[model samples]
Target chain A: MSYNWNWDIFLSPTPSGESTYLGWLLDGLQWTLTLSLGAWIMALVLGIGLGVLRTVPNRLLAGSAAAYVEVFRNVPLLVQLFIWYFVLPELLPTTLGDALKQTDPLAQQFFAALLCLGCFTAARVCEQVRAGIASLPRGQRNAGLALGLTLPQTYRYVLLPMALRLILPPLTSEFLNVFKNSAVASTIGLIELSRQSQQLVDYTAQAYEAFIAVTVLYVLINVLVMFGMRLLERRTRVPGYIGSK
Target chain B: MEEFDWTSIPGALPILADGMLITLEITATAILIGILWGTVLALARLSGNRPLAWLAAAYVNLFRAVPLVMVILWFYLIVPTLLQRWFGVSQSSDIRMISALVAFALFESAYYAEIIRAGVQSVPKGQVDAAFALGMPYHLTMRLVVLPQAFRNMVPLLLTQAIILFQDTSLVYVIGLADFFGAAYKVGDRDGRLVELLLFAGAVYFILCFGASLLVWQLQKKYST
Candidate 1:
C-alpha cells in the first residue's frame, strides 16, 4: 500500500515539455475572467432594469417583473445552463438553429452560458437592488417629488448613489457567487479553470494535485475580490452611516 | 412553435415521480447532514480556543473558496482510490453518495458556521452575564439561554441556507446520480423532447424552491414578531 507521491508532477515539465502547467492554468484563468466579466456586466444591467420594473408604480410591469425574479431566482443555475446550451438552440427556428449549431459550437455554447448565468444571477441582483432602494426613507422620494425631479431623476441622483453604498457588501457577495457559478458553465464544455483542471487530471492521472491547484486558484481569486470589495466599501462608505460593528 | 403538450406529463408522471423521489432524498440528506455538521463547525469556530477556531476557519475557507462541482468531482474520482488504498475495501455508489454528503457537509459547514456565529455574537452580552450571575454553568447557559435565542434569531438565515443546500444537491448528478436534473436530461435524451423536458425540470425546481421560500416566510413571520 506504500505509494510514491510525485511532487514533481506539479512542478516539473510535462512530457511534451513545451507548454508549462502554469500556462494552461493561465489560459483557463483568462476564460474564467472573461466569462465572469461578461456575465457580471449583463447581470448588473438586467438586474437594475428588472429591479426598477418590479418597484415601479405600474402594477402590470411590477407583477410581471416579480414573476420573472421568482422564476429565475428559484431554479438552479445548472439546469438553466443545460437548457440554454442543449435545449434552447434546438427549439429555435431551423435556419437559426443550424447557424448556431454550425457556427463554432464552442463559441456559441460559451455565449449561451454567459447569457444564462447573467440572467440567473440578475434575478438575485434584482432582489438585492430592490431591497437597497426600498430601505431608503419615504421622505427622500417625497422630497424629490416636491423639488419637481422626475421619478427617474430622483432615483438617478439621490436614491441610487445612496442605495449602492448601502448594498455594496451584499453586491460583493453576489459577485463572488457569480464567479463561483461560472463553474457550472464547465459542465457544457467551457474551458474554464475547473474544466481545464479536470482535463489536466484526466490526462495526467493526478487528481489530488489537480484539485489542489484548482482550490488554490479559486482561493486566490476570491481573496483578491474580497480585498478589492473592502477597499471599495471604505472609499464609497457614506459618512454618517454606521455599519454592523 | 410546437404546440404545448399537456398530455405528455400524464404519460411521464411515473418516471418523473421516480426522479422526484431521488431529488427529495438527496436534498433531505444534504440538508440534515449539512446542518448538523455545519452546526458543529459553527460551535467549534465560536469556541474561545484559538486552535479549534483556526481549524474551523481553515475548513470553511477551503470549502467556501472551491466550487462545489470540483468538490464533488474530487470526491467522486479520488475518494474511491484513497479508500481502497487506506481501508482495503471496494467502493460502491452508496460510498460515493456518502462521499458526496461528506464533501457537501464540509463545504457547507463554513457558511453555516459564519451565519450561526453571527447569530451567537448578536446575542446581548448582558444575557450571558445575567446567566452567570444566576450561577448557571457556562455550557448550561449556552445551551439553555444563548443557543435558543441565537437559533430563534437565525431561523430566516437557516431557511435561506436550506434553500441553497437544496439547490447544491443538483451537483450530485455529476457522480451519476439520477437526481431531478439528471432525470430530466435522461428523459429528454431518451425522448428527443429536450425543450419540454427542460421546461418541466425548471418547473420542478421552481416548485421546490418556491415552496421552501414560502415556508421560510411563514417561519419568519411566526418567529420574528
Candidate 2:
C-alpha cells in the first residue's frame, strides 16, 4: 500500500537520449512484430516444404522431413535461440564464423532470433500441414491422377488448395504462437516487447504499469489476429466441408 | 573448429538431474492444479450464469493473451511478498519454485479450460437430457454421467498440454531458477563448452517430449472413431 505509483514514467526522458520509455517500448513492439512476421514467412515456406515431403511416397524424403520435425519441434526455443546465437557461429567454418561475429550486433541478434523462431515454429506448422493433407479423401489424389495430371501437378492444383483451406484455423494458432514465443529472443539480447518491459521495470521501477501496458498491447494483437483469421476462415470456407462454420 | 569434449557432461549430470526433478515436479503440480481450476472455469462457462461466465472468460482471455514469461515474472515479484505478509510464512528457499508453480498453474488453466470446454461440448446433448429424464439432479448428472465421459475424451488433449508444459518449464531460466534448461545454461557457462552442453540438453528434451508425444499420437489414433 505504501508503494508509489508512477504513470508518467513513459513521458520522462530516457537516459540514452534517443526517446522516452514509450519509444523504447514501441521499438520493442516493432522488433517483436518484425521477428514474428519474418519467422512466419519462414515457417510457412519451410513448413509447407517439409509437410509436403512428409506426405510424399519416397521413404528417404519423408524420413528426412520427419527428422526435421522431430529435431526442431522437440528442442526448447530458448535453447535453440542460444544455439543459433552462440554455438552456431562457432560451428561454422572459421571464416564464416568470423564474418558472422563481425556483423552489427543488432542485426546479428535479429537474424539469430528470426532463424531460431522460424525453424522452431516450422515444425509445428509442418505437423498442421501434414494433418491437413492427411484429412483429405484418398479419392481426391486418385481423382487427380485419373485426370492425367502428374503427381506434382496433382498436389499443386488440387490437394494443396483443399488441405490449406482446412488447416487455416490451426495455422492461425501457430501464427499467434510465433508472436508469443518471440519473447524468448530477449534472452539472447533481441530487445523485443518482453525484454523492453523488463528493461522499463529495471529503469523506472513501474513494474505494474510497464507490464500492464505490454499485456494490453499483446491482447490487442491477439484479438486482432483472432478476428482477422476468423474473417479469412469465413471467406475461404468450402460449403459442406467439416468445420466450415 | 575446436575439438569436442564429452567429459563435462558426466560431471554436470547430478546438478542437471536435480534441475530435471524440479522441472518434472513443477509440470506435474501445475497440470493437476490447472486442471482442477480449469474444470471449474469450464463448468462456470457452461452453467449459464452470465456474471460467472464473464469473469471466467476474462481470466482465460487475459492469461492466454499474455506470455507465460511475463506471468512468471509477475508472480515471482508479486506473490511471495503477499504470501509472506498474509500467511506469515517466511520467504523460504523454495519461493522461486513456489512462484513458478503458481504462475504455470494459473496460466495453464486458461488453456486447460478451453480443452475441457470442448470435451464437455463433445458429449451429446441427448446424454444430458437422458440423465435429467432419469430424475438425476443437475450436479449429479454432471458429476456422475457427463464429467466422466468428458474427462476420458479429454485425456489425450490434457497430456498434449502437459508435454507443452514440460517444454515450457525451461523458461524458468528467466527467473534464475535452475530447471533443466537453466542447469544446462549454467553448466555450459561454467565449463565454457556451451555448445556441447546445450546440444546434450536439447537432446534430452527432444527424447522426452518426442517420446511422450508419440504416445499421445497413438492414443489419439486409438480414440478416434
Candidate 3:
C-alpha cells in the first residue's frame, strides 16, 4: 500500500524528551478512564433518580423527570459538551465564574466534560431505568405499597433490586456509551485518547499507526467493559428470569 | 451580566442556514448509505457462511467499539491521502466534507446493523418456513416475507437512529467543516458571543431532535398497536 508504517514511533521519546509517545498515549488513557468512570457514576445516580421519578404516581415529579430526559437526550452531545465547556462559566455569578475560568485548565476541561457526559448519558439511562421499572408487573408495586412500604422504600426495597437486574443488559449498553461519548471531551481539549492520537498524527505523520493504536485501545476498553458487565449480570441474575435458569 | 446579545444572530442566520444544509446533506447521505450497507451487514451476520458472517461481525464490532469522533478523525486524516492520490481532489474543505460523510456512514452502519439484526430476529421462524413452503428462493423469502415485516417493526428504530445521525453530524466539527454547530461556534468566536451562539444552537438542536423523537414515539405506538 506504499504506506510507511512505523510501529516504533511509540517507543521513541518526543522531541521535548519528557516521555515516549507510548507514555503520551497512556496518559491519554488515564484521562479517558477517569472522565468516563466519573461520568458513569454520576449518570447512574441521576438516571435512577430521574427514572424513578418518571414512574412515580406524582404528576409533577414524573413530568419534571420527563422534561429532564427530553432536554438532555435531544441535543447533540457535542453541542452539550460545548455548552458545558464554553458557555457555562459565563452564566455563573461573576466571582464564581471567574473562579471556574481561572482553575487549572485541565481540571476545568475535565469537570466540564464530566458534567456534560454525565448529564447527557443520565438522560438515556433514565429512559432505560424507567422502561425497566415499567416492565415489572403492576402487582409488584401495588404489593409493595399494600405491604406498608412507602413509594421511595418500595423503590429501594422491592422495585429497584428486581428492575436493575432485569435492565442490566440495556444498562450495559448505556455504560459503554459513556466511554464512547467521552471521546467528545477531546474537542474541548481534554487530551483524552482520541486527542492524543490526533496529536500523534500531527507530530509523527503516521496517521494509520496512530489511529490504529487508538482504535485498538478503544476496543480493548469496550471488551473489558462488556466482560465486566457480563460478569455482573451473571452474579446478579435471579433464576428463572431473563434466561438465567 | 447583561442580556444575551442575540444581535449577531440576525446577521448570521444565512451563513448558519448554509451550514445547516451541509449538516442535512451529510445526515441524509449517511442514513441512506448506512441503512443499505447496514442491511447487508445484518444479513451477513445472519448468513449461513461462517467466514462471511465472522468478517461482517468483526467489522461491525470494530466500528461499534470505537467512538464516532475517532472514526471521523480516522477518515479525515486517512482518506484524504488516498483521495488526493487517486482522484486528484485537493481542496481541503471538499476533502473534509467527503471524509465526514464516509466516516458517519461507516460508523452509523455498524449501529444500524445491530438494530436491523434485532429487527430481523424479531420476525418469527414460521414466516421463513411458510415462505419456503411456497417455493420461494432465499432472496425472495427475505424480500417478500421477512424483510417487509422486519422493516415494519424496524421503522421506529430506524427513524430514531436517523435522528441520532442528524444530531451526530455536528461531530464533523472536529474536522473543521462548518456544519450548523460549527458555523455557530465560528460566528460566536468571531463576534465574542460564543455563549449566545452556542445557546442558540443548542436551542435549535433541542427543538428539532425533541420534535423528531416525539414523531418517532407516535410511530412506535402505531406500529406496536
Candidate 4:
C-alpha cells in the first residue's frame, strides 16, 4: 500500500546511458520472439521426422527416435540449458570447444538457449506428432500403399497431409510453450523478457509495475498465438472431426 | 581441459540430498494444492453460473498465459511486501519456499483445470441423467456419480502433470532457494567443478523422471486393457 508507483521510469535511460528502460524491455522481447520462433521451426521439423520414425516399420529407426524423446523429455529444461551452456563445450573436440567458447558471449548464450529449447520442445512435439499419426485410421496408410505408392510416397502424399492437419491444435500449444519456456534462457543470462523485467525491478525498485507489464506482454503474446492458430485450424479442419471453430 | 574432480561430489551428497528433500517438498505441496484448486475451477467452469464461470476462465487463462518464472518472481517480490504491510514480517527470506509453492500451485491449476474439464466432459450424459433421476442434487451427482468415473480416467494424466511439476521445481533457483539443482550449482561453483555437478544433477533428474514416466506408462496400459 505504501509503495511508490513510477509510470515514468520507462522513458528513463539506463545507468550506463545507452537506451531507455523501455528500449531494454523491447530488446528483450525481440530476443524472446527470435529465440522462440527459431526453436519452434527446429522443433517442428525434427519433431515431424522423429514422430514419423516412431511410427515407421523399421524397428531400429523407431526405437532410436523413442530413445531420443525419452532422453530429451525426461530432463528439466533448466538443466538441459545448463548442460548446453556449461557442459557441452568441455565435452566437444578441443578446437571446436575452443571455437565455441571464444564466440561473442551473447552469441554463445543465444545459440545455447536455441539448441536447448529446440531439442526439449522437439520431444514434446514428437509425442503430439506421434499421437496425431496414430489417431488416423489404419485404412489411410493401407489404402495409400494399395494405390501402388511406395512407403515414402504414401507418407508424403497420404499420411503427412492428414496427420499434420490433425495435429494443428496440439502443435499450436507446443509452439506457445516454446515462447514460455524460452524464459528459462534467462538463467544462463540471455536477458529475455522475464530477465529484463527482473532487471527493471532491481534498478527501479518498482516490483509491482515491472511484473505487471511483463505479465500483460506475455498474455498478449498468448492471445495472438491462439487467435492465429484458430484460423489455421479452421482452414485445415477435416470433416466429421472435432476441432477449434 | 582439467579432469573432472569426482572428489567433492561425494562430500556434497548430504547437502544435495537436503536440497533434494526441499525440491520434493515443494513439488508435493504444489501437486496437492494444484489439484484441489483445479477441481474447483473445473467445476466452476462447468457450473453454468455465468459470472462464476467467467471468473474461473479468466483466472485460468491469465495464469496459463504467463511464464512460471514470472509468477514465481511476482509472488517472491510482491507478496512479501503485502505480507509486510499486513503481518509485519521483517525478514522475508524464510518464506521463499512458501512463495514458490503458492506460485506453482496457482500456475499449475490452469493446466489441471483444462484436463479435469475434459475428463468431466468425457463422462457420459446418461450417467448425469441417471444421477438426477435418482433424486440426487446437482452437487451430489457430481460428487458421487460423475467425478469418480472422471477421476478414474484422469489418473495417468494427473501423474504426468505431477512429473512435470517435479521437474519445474528447479525454477525456484531464480529466487536463490537452494533446491537440489541450486545446491549442485553452488557446490559446483564453490569447488570449481560446474561441469561435473551439473551433469550429476541432470542425471538425477533424468533417473527420477524416467522412472516416473515408466510408472505412468504402466498405469495407462492397465487402464486401456
Pairs that clash in candidate 1: none
Candidate 3 per-residue lDDT over residues B87-184, each given as its tens digit: 78666568888889889988999999999999999999999999999899999999889899999999998999899899999998988999999999
- Model 1 lDDT at residue A135: 90
| Chain A TM-score, structure 4 | 0.97
- Give the candidates in order of DockQ, highest first: 3, 4, 2, 1
On lDDT, who's better, 3 or 4? 3
- lDDT for each residue of candidate 1 in B7-108, tens digit (9 for 90 to 100): 566677777788677777766776676667777788888888999989988888777777889888877776677777888875555776667766776677
> Residue by residue across A32-78, what tens digits does model 1's lDDT show?
88999899999999998888788778999999989999888788888
Best by lDDT: 3
Compute the lDDT of residue B82 as modeled in candidate 2. 79
* lDDT over C-alpha atoms for residue B1 of model 2: 57
Best-matching candidate per DockQ: 3
* Residue B177, model 4: Cα distance from true site in angstroms: 0.7
Go through the candidates in order and give the clash count of each. 0, 0, 0, 0
TM-score of predicted chain B versus true chain B for each candidate:
0.88, 0.96, 0.96, 0.95
| Interface DockQ per candidate | 0.65, 0.76, 0.81, 0.80
Q: List the residue pairs that clash in candidate 3.
A: none
User: Compared with the true structure, what per-residue lDDT tens digits does model 4 show for residues B110-179?
Assistant: 9899889989999999999999999999999999999999999999999999999999999999999999
Which sections of candidate 2 miss by over 4 Å?
A242-245, B221-225
Measured with C-alpha atoms, the lDDT of residue A35 in candidate 1 is: 93
Q: What is the TM-score of chain A alone in each candidate?
A: 0.94, 0.97, 0.97, 0.97
